[model samples]
Target: MIAAVNDETNLVEKERKIDAIRWNQAEELSTFDYFDINALLAYLVKVNIVARWTRLDDKQGREMLHRLMTSLDGKDLINKQ
Candidate 1:
């Protein structure tokens, strides 16, 4: 009985926080660099494929993904040359 009431209260609190965040629209309007995001996603997918067929540990995979993302500079990231 108490647990249910507590859960409902928590839910309402979370909903109120979300509502406040929605009203605070100034912070949410910034654009993301989708091209870099996509490139990072592609590299992650390739890593996953290779991992499925071989031994790629979590730590090494994360490090490699981080390195790949940081290496994506604006200079011909998509082979624009």
Candidate 2:
């Protein structure tokens, strides 16, 4: 799966594919945990993964970091679509 992602020539598509893979992995890891802190942690991981790709065009890491930090304070950053 990662090999296929790496083979993608389009940079944006490659990134999106990789993010999808990461999201799937997170979901799989959290599948067994129901309503526990692991579920919450998984949710946060998924959010961060979404944020990473959603803001792919932004070259400034500092701005992205700031937005992620703000999201951590009980605010939904990007809708978990």
Candidate 3:
């Protein structure tokens, strides 16, 4: 009765929160992922995420990040595909 109603309310609120999170992630990518290292770092800190990199040429940097990210099974990068 009352408990059942409360459960449904909680579930709906949880769903709304999840949707908001997905929206925020998409927005962040559009805003930051195409930029320089400092922009990426700022976005990461703001979103409470993490990243790692090495001193390499642009091509090497892309290859290394792509390799590491794929090895992570799409864990924590912009292109999580």
User: What TM-score fits each model?
Assistant: 0.27, 0.60, 0.29
For 1-81, candidate 3 gives per-residue lDDT tens digits of: 333344555664554344345435544555534567755654444333212223323554455456435533534554653
Ten residues in a row with the worst lDDT in model 1? 22-31
For model 1, the superposed segments whose C-alpha errors exceed 4 Å read 1-35, 55-80
Candidate 3 lowest-lDDT run of ten? 47-56
Candidate 2 vs candidate 3: which has greater lDDT? Answer: 2
**What is the lDDT, from 0 to 100, of the residue 18 in candidate 3?**
47
**Cand. 2 Cα-lDDT:** 0.67
Clashes of each: 0, 0, 0
Scored against the true structure, residue 68 in model 3 reaches a CA lDDT of 37
TM-score-better candidate, 1 vs 2: 2
* Candidate 3 ranges with C-alpha deviation above 4 Å: 1-9, 32-81
* lDDT of the structure predicted as candidate 1: 0.44
Error of 1 at 13 (Å): 51
What pairs collide in candidate 1?
none
TM-score of 1: 0.27
